[model samples]
Target: MIDEQTRSLLAGIGGFDPTPGALAGVVVVDVTRVVAGPYCAMILADLGATVIKVENPDDPDYTRTFPPLLTGEGSEPLSGFFAQYNRNKLGVTANLRTAEGRELLERLVARTDVLIENFRPGTMERLGVGPDRLREANPRLVYAALSGYGQHGPYRGRPAYDNSAQATGGLWSMNGPAGGPPTRVGTIIGDLAASLYGAIGVLAALRHAERTGEGQLVDISQQDSVVTLTENAVVAYTTEGTVPEPLGNAHPFVRPYELFPCRDGHVFFGGYTDKFWRISCEVFGGEGTADAHADLSDMATRFDPDVYRDRVRPMVEGWFRDRTKAELEALAGDLVPLSAVKDIGEVVDDPQIAARDMIVETEYDGYGALRTFGSPVKLDVTPPRTRGRAPATGAHTAEVLADVLGYSAAEIDAMRQAGAI
Candidate 1:
């Protein structure tokens, strides 16, 4: 159960409701840093898990120094980038290199429902706090490991960043213009996908633990996660002997399903299906255009490379060239299946995004209201929400140690004196 003080703090944050969250009583020990692992823990935290974020005292999460900082009264500037993924977590620091720090971690793990980490494959084991040891201590503990490769693969020990994962996982090879050099994705899709998958795996493991009282390991690989998103690209090569290549913003097998340039900006048109194609023809190609192109009504004919390149592309480009994004967007509907391509600035103010409460603001003690994203998962009874500002380094160390592990003030002080925290 969350203590009253903690609950009050959460309530003060933006987007919190009086109702208890879905994972209210669950305890999570987040021993991860940076994007992938932190993001996974953040998802659980948003769902009301009591996530205790543990960092190494000597070398904290490097993202803590990332740009776009925020400063509160008498506190060092905090990274908005770090805050984006670390909110709603109690922060604590422990120098795991010391025996005292390792002991503290063991105690915390014994009481934790889930433990997530993103260190290299054997880093935890070398520190003597690996899954085998911790899960032995607590039979119902769910241990999740997020890494670039998995725990047992040949490349498991190799270092990887988002671009490295994208490159090695085959996503980069197929991500650019048809004949252009391979390009990295604009966002960290590799890390984000792995984090999402890691969260799902942790949830599934938690359910299993609840039913059988048995703990398990959830090993998520960024490379594997990225490969899963390739969406039939591998199967196409294996089954039909056709290697996939980049098509820029166009769909590999769908015609008129790509972004089109307009007078002011761009709009994505999705006339791939027969029904939507007819609707698009009526809207863009004018009144009798659908009938005039009756011979190309079938997908096979319209989607053929030669036909699309020579006929359909030119016609669609001609239709879009004279129109403005707003003019094209006005025709968007269920039948048309089109929308204006939105930049970040436009997305923040979009009515649909606003209606969904995707943009949320949280107030810090001295820093004014800071806006970040809202939870995508919405449950009527116990909704997931962003419930607080990110903590300062080890801000909740004394509180968590006392409340969670039943440590005395003297013991905490002794450990602090020894530089264990």
Candidate 2:
């Protein structure tokens, strides 16, 4: 039940009631496998596009066979890996090698609004269904290619995964401690970023097609996407002739902006400005502490590397070490930017996360009900939703051919006999 205030807030905004996706009538043919491509298609599916996962019969998505299968007494074991990123989709098999398969794909392309693939650069063209040929068939189709090195580059042919992208894009250099060896981020940021950029490109291209009925290609490379995230490092190298070294958890230009030790674990506090610095000093002690930091009153002096190393950081560390995380949060609630470093368990139970519905429960076909992440993108109207569990391999092949393509039962059986689906 919603309160009066909450009800009123939702009443003014349309699309609050659950409905079909925002991209409802848009048809997407996802020919990509693996994280980046499947992740992008998943976002589109969440937004209400009717996405058909086009897989080859010989090697279906490897994730579909990945380990940690969910099993029950009367159900076929399902791959949790595939289910994670392939939710809310209709699955089909198209051998692309056979003439009948190619014909079927061509027919699907003729009616599709968007087709995405993340195979090697020339794989699609070699398959006789490249962007140029598909666009010729459907003038308003958005052809999106997500690759490791992009369509054309000196390293275009080089194979890459999340690890290689992070290394090649210079993200590995700036991570970890000052003198420590390079570190990979715990999460797969490179792959995830590429998907986000690819999704944005697809949406923008769809808008352009909607207006003029002319479609274009969207090319996104994981290496390039990771490089874009090295904004400060690029600027420093180009403009200042400086090579930045890792400062552990510290910000490059801000003092008191790093993680600090607390009684139980770790906490982060930011008191970069003079006003916050003075208040922080008062909180630490009072007049004595203020006098000690009097020379570091201005922003320039406060952030100076030498001053921060010799004085500010040590003082802050010592002050933080004396207090518990809860104590510091209470004392500096709104006075300074402070946060406790929470683990995964804490994050799951966090009040703010619960309030925002950042984690939601979804029912997997064979796995029963499980908790998965909710969409971070919140549109007061037309919010993204999880349609259902990920489909079984070629689960919709017969259904789609019959209902969507208007094929007769005999035609569907013939195609199956010929191994075209």
Candidate 3:
């Protein structure tokens, strides 16, 4: 839930707080550098957590060097990709491999409620910040571990990215149009999906620990999460002993549930119900059950889906061709389930998204203000609002050491000079 003050502020007609900077109280220690880990920490920061993102100086996040970093008045080595994923985080560089650095992290850990890291199995254990040590340091610390495989199994120690996970999990094999080779999803679906799952697990664990003073390690596998995105391919393989092929945008076993051509773009329409099928037929000026009954009525008849697809395609395509994106979204919302496959620009420019505050803008000191997607979750009393831009590397190192770890300025200066911070 959004806070009373925030809600009241938002309800004041014109606009609420355009730039709600810091989220007070909650603190998070982010031990991750790349996408999935940083994404989880960013979400926590958005939800009022004071996130401290740790980075190894020698091996900085690859994304930091992702080319042509944003330039501006207060912009400090900002990566275009990093900015989007790590909006509200404070970056601090530390050589965790060093004894002093590890001890510094331990001191920070003493004040952290949550820790996020994505590495191969036992990687953290080797680094001395594994769940057990973190728990001992802070008895109620909720640690989230995200990896390619998992904490166990033969491939647990393997490294992977979004493409690898999709291929290993059978999701790639189920992609593309029919007769196409296995292909990874266009977006980093596996990585982001695993992050979302990790976030949920973290919050759930946090709640339990807060209630009973018990903390647990959350194990999120990108491969396992990717497997869930396999859609109906595995079901067809196990149940009917049929190896499914690339289905593109259509359901493998369902008829009329596919994409069709539109005037400007494409429309994804159809559902499981016979009612929508009937309505679809009516939209094409054909009798609901006159010719499409073979695919509609007989469940087993889907074995030869091409026969019904021939008749259904032109019918839905006709309706889509006659309508615009706006018209299609409105009609779909009113009549049946449908969607306009608008591009990224279209999505960001949508008015409805604006009204929902789904698209937001925040001023960055160096880069002015830019609009981007908002968090998906909505809380009435504790809303997750964008709290300014990401901090510069080592920007909050002194402040965090002083405030959380209670280190003296002399000690902080020494740590900086040694390059172990």
Candidate 4:
């Protein structure tokens, strides 16, 4: 059961309470902009943490001005991109350049359990809220910093985005075709990966703080996070002196592990072992089962690139090219591992994803209803829920000032007149 104070807090902020999530009573002060830091804070918010998103009144998060705006008939417009990452948060505008603004932030930090920021290495220190200062105010606050490069390094002060981090961290080199030009990933994986790691670090630090009454800084680098996705690139180079390159859609080690062109679209299938290979031969119905191809039955022979490219893939491609997606599904049944390549529209409308509530409809003040991706981590006991829509710019400014900071109406108006919030 939720406490009356928590229920009133939720009601005052226009937040919903679908289920009691893991971080019900936790408070997060999110002074982050752009994708990485906001995403980390959103993850905590999804788990029922009360996240207060701090934005500068002069220069708000850049995404607030981005395109694809959702507007009501008479209300203001809101950016869909901003709403996607900043959901279930209380938005506040504070001019950090002013003394009053920093005082407000200091007050919020004193009672917050966690704080997330993605500014450059020394930016927080310049704002007079560095780790040392924050620790003095609240020793048990879990402070997290998400950056392109880590806090201490040669490239710490250098600027980097998702593309830069991907290029510097070997993802660009390891992607694309075997001999083709370097290609960027379709999405901002570098920033997103760093956010996930940063969120995990915050959770762990919070647990530590809960037990020992001490908190530490969590520093996550986008470049470092992107490097972890290079499947076995490091091991191949360090152990065998082999620098791996992209093999298109095919696996470097597994044979028949590639995308095949079908009649209408594409399908990816894999069958390496004898049992599955025999099943694959039946479904493919080609020279893959001939006596001349007997040597290819062994996993080693199939693992050979020449054998796979010259003999195996050709047969499979020919078979798949002649069959439709439905026919192949019926023919293969569940014996073989196979799935048709789907586009974004197909994925969004997929029955499996729909059944699992992967896409949900949430309502905002200006935007009546918006469709957004739901949380992937689902716990049986206390599953995370999307309580409410993303807030408008500085929507909870007065409410937060009154409830959290105990600022009277006159004081709030005075600060606003001073251009502090």
Best by lDDT: 1
Most accurate candidate by TM-score: 1
lDDT of all the models against the reference?
0.86, 0.80, 0.73, 0.84
Q: What is the lDDT of residue 67 in candidate 3?
A: 52
TM-score of each: 0.95, 0.90, 0.87, 0.94
- The superposed Cα distance between candidate 1 and the true structure at residue 64, in angstroms, equals 1.0
lDDT of 3: 0.73
- Descending-TM-score candidate ranking: 1, 4, 2, 3
Per-residue lDDT of 383 in model 1: 81
Candidate 2 residue pairs that clash: 21-48
Model 3 stretches astray by more than 4 angstroms: 1-25, 67-69, 74-77, 283-306, 326-333
Worst 10 residues of 3 by lDDT: 7-16
Model 4 lDDT per residue over 17-82, tens place: 646688887888899998999999999988888888999988889998677788886355778788
Clashing pairs in 4: none
Candidate 2 lDDT score at position 341 = 86
Candidate 2 lDDT, tens digit per residue, 1-421? Answer: 1124322332232222236568766778899897899999989878877678989877788887776677765256777767778877778888898887887787778777889999989888888989988888888989999988899989888888888889888888888887798888788888899999989999999999889989999999999999998869999999999987766898889787889998988898898888888888888766678777578788789788999889888888888897888788888867888888889898889888988887777665446775666678777777787535677778787766665666789988888888887
Better of 2 and 4 by lDDT: 4
